[model samples]
Target: MIEVAAAIIENEQGEILIARRKKDKSQGGLWEFPGGKLEPDESVEACLKRELREEMNIEIQPYESFGVNEHDYGSVHIRLFAYKATFVRGEIVLVDHDRVEWVRPKALKAYEFAPADVKFVELLERE
Candidate 1:
């Protein structure tokens, strides 16, 4: 199973960051809490930080665990670890994604998320 780390990054204005997958990638065109799979020997927090920097060109400080979800996509199974995070610095840049948005938690429901991210979205919407 792939171990993925997802960041529930919120800005000072209380808006959360979400990214749209590149159209050519797996689960493409869906919005997701920006993050990526963990690399070997990497801590969950480290993975989250690295992924946000590498994929989104932003710095973040991941905090407490938010939740976890396991999903199977036929070809792959992933265990997603969600963590609450705060944006630290840097301008946003899209690398692995097509677009990024800072949205209110309740407003997240309007976007279709990857199956693995649905649970996180639901929980955020309730906050």
Candidate 2:
């Protein structure tokens, strides 16, 4: 399984941060929670912090484990860990994704998110 760590970053206005995948990427043109694959010897927290920095150029203080989901992309299987986090510092500078947005949970369904993220979006809507 490919281990992945992502954050559910909530802004002061109570909107969640979502990143848009580049058209050439695997899950091209889909929106997703910002994160990356976990590396060897790295804890989920460390992986999250590192990914946020590398992918978005921002820092966050991860709070609790929000949820987990798994997805099968034919040849690849991914196990995703979601965490609730608060933005700590830096302006978001997108490096991997093409766009980013702060959206309300109710509006989540309006965007085409990765399959793995759909469950989390449901969880958010239910809560």
Candidate 3:
């Protein structure tokens, strides 16, 4: 199983951050949360902190653990830990995505989200 962290990256305006995948990626052009796989020896919170820095150049105050969802992506099992992050610092950097967006929960459906991320959006909307 692979461990993943997802950021419900909320901006000061109460919008959530979503990233657009590059056209050549596995889930190309699909919108999803910004985070990466966890390395061994790091906690979920720490993994989130590191991933936010690496993927978006931002420091995140991972104030809460929202939820965890386990899913099957064909051959691989995915364990996704989602977090609510308050943006701490730095400019928005796009090191791995084709585009990024800060959008309201209701507007989430406008984008073609990854399968796992679609589940996450439902959870967000229900909140």
Candidate 4:
């Protein structure tokens, strides 16, 4: 299984941040939490921080893991680790995703998510 990191990134207005993937990405054009693959010897929190920094040009304090989701996308299997985090600081830099949006928790369900993110969204809704 491929280990992945994802964030339930929240903003000051009590909204969550979701990124729209570029058409070439694995789950191209779908909305997903900002994060990436976990590197060797890296803590999951560190992976979350590194991914946000690289993918979105942001710094975040990923204090804890709140949920996990697993899914298969035909070729590869994914193990997504979801974290509950506050946006500590960042400039809106779109490196991988096509667009970024600050959306309400309920509004998040409207977007198409990768399979693993479907369950993650349910966890978000439960909050």
Candidate 5:
């Protein structure tokens, strides 16, 4: 099973950051809480920080454990760890994703998310 870390990065205005997967990638064109798979032996917090920096060119301080979800896409099974994080610094840059957006929690349902990430949207919306 692949271990993934996803960040629910909230800005000062209380908007969360979500990214759109590149059209050619797995789960393509879907919006997801920005994060990535964990490197071997890496802690979830470290993985979250590293992934956000590498993929989005931003630094984040992961402060709380939001939730977790496991899903199988037939080809691959992933256990996703969601963390509540604060955007620390750096200019936003898209590396693996096509676009990024800061959206209100209640508005997240309007975007189609990867299956594993769908649970988080419902969780956030109730907040």
Candidate 6:
């Protein structure tokens, strides 16, 4: 299984940040948390920070693990580690995703997300 890390970022307005997948990429046109696969021997928190820097061009302080979910996308199997984080610094410059947006948690369900990310969304809705 591919080990991946994802960020659950919240803004001062109580909105959650979600990124849209690039149209030409796998899982294209779907919304997902800003993160990527964990590198070899890297901790989840470290992986998340690295991914945010690379993908969003921002610094993040990941606090805790919110949850974990597993899913299969045909040939790809992923084990996702979701962490609650706070945006630290830098302007968000989308490199992997097409766009990024901060939305109220209640309204997050309106956007379609990857199957693996759907579970985390449901968990947030419960909070």
Top of the candidates by lDDT: 5
What lDDT does the true structure give each of the candidates?
0.94, 0.91, 0.86, 0.88, 0.95, 0.92
Q: Work out candidate 5's RMSD over C-alphas.
A: 0.5
**Model 5 misplaced regions, further than 4 Å:** none
Q: For residues 63-103, what per-residue lDDT tens digits would candidate 6 score against the true structure?
A: 98999999999899999999999888889898889889998
CA RMSD (A), model 2? 0.8
Cα displacement (Å) at residue 123, model 1: 0.5
lDDT of 3 by residue, 45-113 (tens): 888889889877889888898888888879788898888888888898887798998899888888898
Tens-digit lDDT track of model 1 for 18-56 = 999999999999999999999999988999999988987
Better of 3 and 4 by TM-score: 4
Better of 4 and 6 by TM-score: 6
Q: On a 0 to 100 scale, what is the lDDT of residue 127 in model 1?
A: 75
| lDDT of candidate 1 at residue 4, scale 0 to 100 | 97
Error of 3 at 91 (Å): 0.8
* Candidate 4 to truth, TM: 0.95
CA RMSD per model (angstroms): 0.6, 0.8, 1.1, 0.9, 0.5, 0.7
lDDT of 4 by residue, 33-95 (tens): 889999988878999888998888898888778778889888999999999888999798998
Q: Which portions of model 2 miss their true places by more than 4 Å?
A: none
Per-model TM-score, in order, reads 0.98, 0.97, 0.93, 0.95, 0.98, 0.97
lDDT of 4 at 29: 91
Q: For model 5, give the 10-residue run with minimal summed lDDT.
A: 92-101
How well does candidate 3 match the true structure, expressed as C-alpha RMSD? Answer: 1.1
**Model 4 lDDT, full chain set:** 0.88
